[model samples]
Target: MKTLQIVFIALMTIFTLNAEATEYHVSVNGNDNNKGTAAEPFKTISAAAKIARAGDIITVHDGIYRERVNPIYGGANHLNRIVYQAAPGEKVTIKGSEIITNWKKEKGSVWKVVIPNSFFKAYNPYSDVLMGDWFNKKGMDHHTGEVFINGKSLYEKSNLNDVIESKPYEEALDQEASTHTWYSEVDANNTTIYANFQKFNPNKELVEINARESCFYPDQPGINYITVRGFTMNQAATQWSAPTAEQVGLIGTHWSKGWIIENNIVSNSKSVGITLGKDRSTGHNVWMYNPKKGGATHYNEVVFKALQIGWSKEIIGSHIVRNNVIFDCEQAGIVGSLGGIFSEISNNHIYDIWTKRIFRGAEIAGLKFHAPIDMLIKNNQIHNTGRGIWLDWMTQGTRVTGNLIYDNTTDDIHVEVNHGPYLVDNNIFLSELAIRDWSQGGAYAHNLIAGKIEVRHSTGRNTAYFLPHSTKVAGVSEIYCGDNRFFNNIFIKDENGEESEQEKENQSYGLHGYKIAKYANISSGNSYLNGAKPQEGETNFVEKTNLKPTIKITKKDHHVFLEMDLDPSIFNVSTSIITTELLGATFISEAVFENPDGTPYVLDTDFLGNERDKNKPSPGPFENLKKGLTLYNVGK
Candidate 1:
């Protein structure tokens, strides 16, 4: 009986080993030749990625990995996703920068570094200037390469003389800093970078250069079902990514599907931080303007072939970029074109985008996306940026809710050239210009708009929309900024629970269109108080009432936005304008509009993830401005 029991136990142990998933470990002290175990781990993540299969977990210890990690394969299914995670509570840094210890002092506080051409090997970003489809060269040379000192990126000077002759870096307002300026000159066999680092010893501090093009990206296409989490990824020599060009980001999901990149710190990217975009081919007719290099057919032939090959769900992208802290990018924190279909980007803190004018382009924002069909962007705090969010082109069936946006230099949210059925709800817009509507058919409800609003009639602008949930071209449609609605909102300029002096002086009448034409728009059930005046002549706003609900915002946290407490019962007064009416474009019904995946969605929860009473919900992103109702609030 004992022998029989031992045999059965051995058989059960073998079966359990077969069913269990593998865990691979990586540490700095390990070697690639060693077995990927906890004691004998691999040296690099690239080595682990080469052998990692479905249901494998790569556990990297606390250290800085200088090399880029290119995932060759994703999992066969979501359940078998390959996860790459930093050890719990460990600081794992995956950087695209290489420390240069070969610097020779040129003069007082000026240094020069000569890198052999073999150092870069296949690709040299210093020689590669920024000029591509939809990219304006502006008759000047611009490289994707960057130089960093101690962590912050230094300015790239046009010439060596500019850095050498310049005085102490000027703290000019709204201008790019010239401190620690650098210039690069590339020859056939070497690339030399000269920098002026006044008062700082280059030999003592960590001076790094943007050596790699991307920090974490797969080379080949269709690498899906992967998760990159809990690491600090930074300092890539990423170039300007236009929809027409081969779009590359610091960490981009390139024309793939089902990727989740969460809980990582992405920063100091040269152009863009994260890209869930198409893999460069001829997109729409956006290349016609830059005809000197190539015509429209020449630039877009690859896209035409791609379309013929079928731009469907199996080929396009649907990625989840959530719970990330992405900042310090020149162009955009997150930018996507056409590849953001059926994706969810939630609980990400994206800020400090496009604050530096060192790189100039029309494409600059905190979060800019093109053709985000049925994508959800929620519970994000975007502040201190140029443009908060720019949803351009075919933005059908998309929902932007539970987001707190404020202090943007330009318009907080710009919805351009989209047709209809998109929903924008429960957002806090506090800035100079809130919503810039070039094309309409969006439903705006339960929002707190504390800024100016503008509308542009773009009936002649021809755009495209995709089939719901797929990238197949639905049809070509012109921009018709009509049949829009705004309801159950709170527009105010109260400083301290009452009208500010600016509101009393009629400075709050900051809503207007170009006034060339008016469309069928509805604006009602909105409480505009604290001396804020209703927009005139165009919108069908309900009669304005002067009632100020108490707004409580405390600066408890230092980095991101503060928490607010505004009890919903405070607005439950006798003169309240609350109702159960459907907000926004009423014509956007089942017959005309459905979700991209043909599924239906209801905004049943507030920004704090609390259930909302659909019959009479309060205004703004909170169901109740109770304390502790933050993005991380778990309905306590």
Candidate 2:
């Protein structure tokens, strides 16, 4: 009778809390002083966020909100969480930039603007130079500030003279827009900017500049179970998101868990777009401050330090970042370190990342993560970035599946220094270099590799690997290079004489690069075409020298299509369904390739969610794919 009474009281309390939950509204035409109702809404999102409790809803109506929304509180749990969403069929843009109209003509195509330092209050992004561990300034200074004209971002110049006498940058992807540059000078009293607007008049046109560090991010950590949905968040002056530092993005979940960021257009961040990363207390730019110790050593120490201070699954990670369009970021489209463990990143279109090529670093990519233990990255279309997906450090039990990647300047996927039981399956790798394998113990299945694969041993640096589906460090070991299993993959070589001189010199095309590997490797049922080579000591393989399949990606309206000329006879090769039992375990980590929840993964479905043949599965991402110039509508 006593136990039943206790349970009843708990149930009643939950019901009361749900009954009392309120819905607050925010609109541009509304006043903060009014009651946050549909008729009288709040003026800013920050106002509603302050008083919102668990199970509360904050609905923002259509309009541009030009302020940082710092949520003071998070929900108690995932069941009863705080939701900040745009009104249905309405467009709401949250920005870290403010419109600037004051301008003076400095030269024929140059315009100048001077503003009081009081306008920025405490934090001025113009003076905040981008710096962190593993970030190379490239002998030039770059700030976290930006100048925009009519929503188009202008390139940053180092000096006022460069802005005045602007010339097209030879290395820029779009050289014509490079001439429109901006340079800033900040002092104790005022901030001044000189910009080469070219033909546009700054006073007459819509001009904006970076005013804040982040658009929507909590100042402190432990803000958990918050949902940010259906808002166009852009143009934030975010800083460099290094693995050793507190990564602040345009919209970030700083060291938190259970955040669902979906259905929004995120773009034009000064550095990173979305960050689900660590906080400053664990270790902030320790490598930059202490160079005597190597980066790998520092990161290992940081991991232990993080574990000591609540880095478990209960407190950090498990973020859901899906169905968002992210582009035009300099550093990474999505970045995280240890705090990205057990998260799901899916169906996001990330492109045009690091295209400016102004600053070089080891951390630039479409999606970059460190210590992503049991993370699921699936169905994302990443292209035209520096690297497609960079899974660095302790990438244990992670799965990369159903992703369409192409046109990346660097490799499609770079698995660096990880003794992994990680799995890469059903992926389309279309780049000059598909895989840059610096670590070991990976399984690649049903992938269409149309580029060279570079394999190397990280003998000098030893990296950590964790227990299965957990953050507990199991062991640390230097990479022996090839404890990898490759099965049912399609390898193709470019028949056209378009190979770079360096690629020809290295001879990195196909599995031939794995010849010099130090450890054990396996390859079976892999098909090679158009002079692509097979690995040494492999028996089960297919080859076609005369078949040259031309693969290209074409965009029509909002849809992206993969146009490829494939022969249906290629499916005649024998292949079986991949499973955890066949994958075995990594030598160092002793972890098996399984799902994030420790469930067995049977590769029974194709990339398009079609069931594979039970007896003999087809190779590549598709099952029984058609021949002769077929087009696959890869959703953007």
Candidate 3:
């Protein structure tokens, strides 16, 4: 029995050693020498992260940690996947901690310090009171007027600005504000404060003021499927002397893929909030940069590009962008894609974007795809932007449907490319606006296109202005108006009785050869006007051309059928062509002409021979064509 007991004890000891788990605890007041247990924890999160393995959790206790910690694992390919979670109800703050070594005092009705030219290249002039007001409005703490020079209070000196202006190394720190109050000015002499604030001290470090590095890094590669969550990134000051691209915060490059940045507060950056590269050719990827870019800069020029994707390459497959709130960015709130394929961007709220010029209002485009293919943009609310949604530069085969666009300064939805099989349907453009260069081969069917439909060439020259050229051009080569179809739509005019007749004429400007059928149900109150008084309760039929060709039915069978061989030249005739063959009683339900491989044949000028002269109508073989006729239908 005693020998059995000894064997059992040895087995139990080996099992315990093999199955044991390790936990690392970090506390603000704990020492680094401690064992990192629940009762005795490490002092810093960085220390714990250094020793943590793949399946480790580092629990942080509640307190303000003023140290800037780079929690990147050298061994692990993914940097942010390592979670740094805090205990419940314990708020851990990571911010810049500036310890004042000396102080100085200055006397003035308006507390001012003249920074010497030797310290910085330029200076920003704004009173502390003004800054206080801005901070209060933004829900930040305020500062007072007492000046300190390196933690020691300064004596009230006469002409203090002059002293600082002459001295390069001189530092003036404000002590009139609370001990915790810290602010730095942008001037020559304040370079010391700037350097001092940014100084990194591992021993008793202050919170990191610049959290820009926490967002993203461009140089890294193969960083796919990583998520960074639950953190606040403070703004980093911009180096105005440097180029715009070099300005700080979360920059990405071509190789970056499958990254998800969510539930983070980013503010007060010099340039854009988040910047994405032009890497569209990278397939099967999903990347998102969301929420705020935190902090305040001296330049009112501060703007946020909350999310930027694809300025260079085409991104494809399983891309999703939704539910992000972006505001008060300088250039554009969200700028996406000059061109790409198979991408979906929807349900993002963008507002308060400002630009420098008058014609350039707060430009916020819901989805700006230049020459995109096979894309779908639906169910987004875009309002109060300079141009709500713009599709420029040969956008093809894309669908902009089911989005609610209102209160935009310019056209709600603008499509510039003229070569496309794109579909713009089921979208609500609350304002009656103009869509330019819509002569592309596609269907604008089942949509409430309430605004004035204006069609023009590239130079803003209305298609109506080219009437003389329309006559001279042979055979309506690319019937700018015809090849497309618009059916089952509603057009509403301005209810305020303000639009003019010429404007209305401009609205319904280009309707030469386009087929607008089944529009009899269009409401009378929805007036169509140009640059004239609002035509009240006027309903106009879309004039159909006599050149529309009809398909005749001939015979039908179970698996084989036949129809009249209608040549393409039949389109040039000015009268609707109709033929009644032997009524085979086998009625033709629907007849459509398709290419050999099954795509619908597009009828353009190439398909139709040529346009007849305006003075003389083109002669047709009406009497000769009546000789032989055939119509057939083949089905399963």
Candidate 4:
């Protein structure tokens, strides 16, 4: 009788899967009236999305699609996913801009174009300045709208003089088209844009305006179990997505679960690129969370609302964002709020993330995530960015490992107010200010960190850790910025290293006030090379040094490079690698990453996806990552 029941369940599963599986096709030259078949493809992706069900597949052909795709439904699970793919080996470009060709010449290298108010019927990004909760405008108003000429995003100029005087080449960041500036004026009936093309003929080149709010975003929530693959989504006039607001991006998985966004080139946004964040909600009580009459309340209200709106393990985020080339944004390449729980972000190459130095905000980085409960960031190469990874509040059971990060304007990893049991390991951090810690209860091991290290504790600011496999918030108290461990790592300060960059400004590197918090942070068995100095007057660090380690160092293309060639038999870390005495918190030992519930989440994997020796793992990301391993260059 039990065997019969088992057979009945298997049959039911097969029947349900087969009932849901279907295929759809989309093309630029097709018609919306046609059925979404290979020979009779739909014209718009939105049309196919309206009819697609769970376990369906939508294959888009090679062409430029000039519309936004708002998917309403995600499939049930991984096996029953709603897959959206570019036709195999075909190029797909989805743009949020419309081609505007009716430009009349006004002055030298300046052109004027008038678009009717009715043209932007529902939305006009030009009228929307970058304003939101917790946003620092820097006393100037930057708009969400943008103008692009010949596939490059032009700068937004206030006046014709600002356009003529704009020197993009002299800009500090390596920008593609910053020299081309534009200005917009909106009246009751029409909107006008004055642009500087800088001697380029506007009649010959392709010019476009911000016609859509987002490139490939769903306006509604709970779009889950969707896989978007092999496309180039760009040129959106997206607004700022603070946690308090509805976090939208060029392509966002807003408040979704089990989504896989892979193998796409997502670029050219006024704000964020890809966002895995919460829906509109009242965020925690922090810097700007409250205003006199109209501001938000405290952290307990935020947590209570999360509970009210289903903050369980099944409802919140568990998305997979991997292998995508995301770049060229004023804000972040990727960002997430409470919706980044139980997620894996790996193998994505992110670069050139910040160009707006005139505006200052706490929400800009290559990747910025708030409340990353058990989130995994691995094997991703992030460079030429403003800051690499900013893991803010509620960062318990998080692991940042097996990744390559460098060429950032600020620190590679910056952890703010939290009582963490987080781990940082096996990373190549070649930045000027790597590992800027403001929180504590972290264990650092087997990393190659290069920069000034600093930590700060606060009495007013605080964060929370959680109970495992759940959102039952625990360890909720004032900020504890201590109980950290540093072991078996490499710190380099060659003349060819970070000191060269600091000396370019005649500035000094390394910790300036590190000895004050010596008891809070601990260290051991670390190697220092080329005058790389640790915090002076700190006697708590076990086996610390400042001289060159017994290793080879070389330079190629203005970057300092080094590797360990010692015998494997001689490579062993002490059993006192980590303990309750080292980290001022309780921990369970696992050969791999375990969740708060003692369930195995990840185990013994290197940056190259190679297995680490469970018994005696080597120091650093590569067990044997040699040959064509380019660390750095003049241009990345």
Candidate 5:
């Protein structure tokens, strides 16, 4: 009975170990011959990722790993989703080595310059003393200003004196060194000093950087959905070659999708930190052509309407991008212009964007929607950029609401050739200026615009343009400039305090309109309050004299009618009168007349002529009339 109980316990222990998920441990000091368990671990992350399967987690132990590890090739298998995570209370740092090389010493130079390794411990005051102590205990001199590693220099020649002065080598050997801690000056020089180190965790600071060519993958489509989390990648500035047709940080392909990059710090790269390819057709015609149509002669000119749904048919909708922090890149951060739809970009802080010499402009918006449909850009803070939000041609049904934009060098929100009904509401634009050309159909309501809103015509100058002539028709028009109810909007000119009475009087005489009508809503608070009063004009009437008959009416039963055509050009005409009269006579039937060309005209009686004599008749029996006229003439 005792032996059976012991056997049951042994079986239970083995089953518990087998049921647990696989955990591959990685450490800088581990040996290659050891297993990837915690007790026996591998040294490099590249090796650990090679043997990991899907749903497997790679636990990285604390230490600075001074080599680059490519995780893309091993991460290509769909069943092998690799996760590189750090252990609790342990910081796994992947950075450059901190040794000096290429020493050139000359007389009267005041100091010798040497290039340091990418990740040197001398940048931090606390870590510098430890590094100095390690060198001093090895019988090396403490007066040396710098150290070289792998034939590369770390500190500049001008910074050698500051580096020597800031060293705590002598104080580190004293008995009172434990009570005092050193702090460096915070300035641009300090930023440059920190830039030399590949990674620096200044007690409470989070360090993130990326090395060039550290991640590699083949150009294929089956390798989708790669995720990277909780890492600081320090990329060398001059090491990264220009991006070819087949290269990227997370995944390398001309066309690839379903990548998840989050919770990582990346900096200092040539092309981009995270890039998704938009241009295909480099190496093979297979990926270039549409595969679902069974090789039906793919033409590059044919563009697909929806890319995200066509690329990954398993997902019922488009993908989601959220919760990422990207900073200090060579190009626009998070550029996904590869024909995607229904994507959400929220809660991301993208700033400090720099451009190359070839490209002219820079962009640092929290979210940029470039020709995307059914997109939502909300609840983001974008500031100190070139342009806050930019929309190019054919952007439809996009809702830009609840965003706070300020302090940008250019416009806050810019849109062009957009046919969709944009709902721009509740957006607070504080100290922002926008110069937009045209808007066909949209609603700009409930927005708190503190600055000037300038809408100009695209084809002409900055003067106010009129609405088109065809807007008064009965069909549905594209522009709905109604219900936009502006209330409590204040406009302060430059001469608000110093406004003269003469300038006020000149402004009171408003603009004249001949072919177009104008609507002026001047408030009581304006300076032109008592300039012009509204007046009603007098209506003139006319009596017609000579009328023309349409046909010769000789029979007694035939009805005789007089048709008189009055001229409206003789009246005092104005735009307000014309607009009111045209609107009032839209439904009257008998007063309407049509010209020979079938165009409608109005019969106003202001210009008809009167007859000279009313007693004259045509071909009357004139014997009694002539005798009366003769007697009257003789008596007179």
Candidate 6:
């Protein structure tokens, strides 16, 4: 009775503390000196953030906030998290850019603006060149500074003459928009920007220039349990967010934990959009500073060093990044290294990543992570990216499930240099190159794969793999290739699909790409259509070379649909529901494909969250997919 009374008293204390939590208000027509209330609000979000404590809420009204919100303190735990949100049914935009109207006319359609160097304070983005370990500048200079005219970003030219000429570049995605170019000349005293606005006058339009590095990011590490929601955050001068460097985004966590960044539109970053990455203390571009070792060697060294300095589930990760629309970023939409471990990234629409072909890099994707151990990447629609989901190194116990991935210039998924016990299930891959499997020990099940696969071995770089559902490194092993399980998947090839002659010749569809690998794959109960071949010594697969099903992706009114004609007899193959016990253990990591909490996963749900048959399951992502031409709403 005494123990029960003590527990009740503790619960009552928590309830009382939560009940007395403060709610601060911020508005554009307010003063910093005023008391933060609904009647008398704070002028800036930074003002309210300076005073907000645990379990407090900062409600920002509808306006354009042009300052970077650096929260002074973080909540103690998830239950008492400090939330920074836009007012309900309000349109709030937080930008890293400042409006500029002092543009003098130059020759032709070009204009020039000279700003004092004191305006940039400590960091001048125009002078800061994009350089990192894996970042390739394509033999051209690319600055983090950007020029926006009426909410549209202009392409950066290498020289001022290019802005004066105003000719469209041949390789640009938007050829006409390429003519709208900007060039910067940075001196010790001032920074001059020359831009070709075409017909639009920069002084008359809503012209803005990149002034800040990040819009909403904590300056320090250990700022945990913060939530940012319902804001349109954009136009940051984020740098090249390679894994070896400090990855600052438009709104980043900066090696923090329990940050919930959701229900916001993140766009127009010079590099990455959202970052859940490591700090510089662990190791920052050590390989770039001294090129004595390869990138893999430097990364492997950093992993052990991070472990020594407390890299675990309790300290880092467990972030929730969901329901966000991220786009127009030159690099990754969501990127992290070791700091993304045990995180959940779902229901996000990430696209247009690396769309600007001005630069190339080893790390360019919709979502890229180096050591995403025990992470959950589910139900996200990633399209029109360089690569869809790129998971490199130490991908143990990770699950990439129910994602609708398509139209990627590179492969839909690239798993590189990790002996994973990871799970890829119930996904729709409609790109030309579906899975680029450089690493091994993954379980691919119940997926609708409509493209070619590139399976190769990684013998040179020996990457680390962790214990099941944990960050502890069990062993380090080179990928000999193919300790993988491919079960109940549908591989389709468009024989009459729109392709150039060279593209058709280069296409090697389905599991045939795994033939040249050193190791062998465990393949069974898969359906191959239109010249997609099965693995060698596989007797349980189905082939339909004569049957041609019309398959294509359609987008209308911001909704994505998979228009496909599947025969009803496609479900004739006998397949069992996959489970952790049946998958057993991976060869290198000895980790079973399980949940983050080390529980066995039952693959009983389809891509649309429909219940699968327990006895004999269907061989694709959809359980009750109709016959003939059916338009399935895949974006939901």
Query: Candidates sorted by lDDT, descending order?
Result: 2, 6, 4, 1, 3, 5
- Between prediction 2 and prediction 4, which has the larger lDDT? 2
Candidate 1 error regions (>4 Å): 1-20, 136-139, 167-177, 281-306, 493-518, 535-554, 557-601, 625-636
- Candidate with better lDDT, 2 vs 3: 2
**Residue lDDT tens for model 1, 65-127:** 998899987875566778999999999999998898767898777899999989987878799
Candidate 5 achieves a global lDDT of 0.35
Question: What tens digits encode model 4's per-residue C-alpha lDDT throughout 355-397?
Answer: 6454557788898998888888877878877889999877777
| Clash totals, every prediction | 5, 0, 68, 0, 20, 0
TM-score to true structure, per model:
0.85, 0.97, 0.43, 0.86, 0.45, 0.97
Q: What Cα-based lDDT does every candidate model obtain? A: 0.73, 0.90, 0.36, 0.73, 0.35, 0.89
Q: Across residues 1-636, which tens digit of lDDT does each residue of candidate 5 receive?
A: 999999999777555544554888988878867899899889987787666654567888888665545444323333344556767667665543232223233222222322233333234221221110001122321111222222222222223343344333332222222111112222323322222222222222332222223333334434444555566543322111111122243322223434445555554432244444333433123322334632212211112322322432232112344455555443334443332233445545454443211122222232343334445555444454445666543344455554555555455676543433344543544333532323333333223343334332232211111111111112212221111112111122212122246433212111111002111211111111112111111122111222111111121333221121212222121111111123221110111112212243221211111121222211111111221112111100
How do the residues 1-636 of candidate 6 rate in per-residue lDDT, one tens digit apiece? Answer: 999999999788778769989999999999999899999999999999999988999999999999899988998788888999999999999999989888999988999999999999988899989888898888789999999999889988999887899788776677888889899999989999999999999989999999999999888988999999999999999988878777888999998899999999999999999999999887888889979989888988888888998999999999999999999999999999899999999999999887767888988999999999889999999999889999998888889999999989799999998788899999999888899888889999999999888777855998887767778887888888888999999998866544455543334666866766666778888999988878778888889877778878888988888998997576577799999988888887777878988789899999998999899888989888797899988994
After TM-score superposition, the amount by which residue 524's alpha carbon in candidate 6 deviates from its true location, in angstroms, is 1.4
TM for candidate 5 is 0.45
Model 2 earns a TM-score of 0.97
Task: Give the number of the best model, judged by TM-score.
Answer: 2
lDDT of 6 at 419: 89
lDDT of 6 at 442: 93
Please give the lDDT score at residue 53 for candidate 3.
Answer: 49
CA RMSD of all predictions:
6.5, 1.7, 21.3, 4.9, 28.6, 2.1
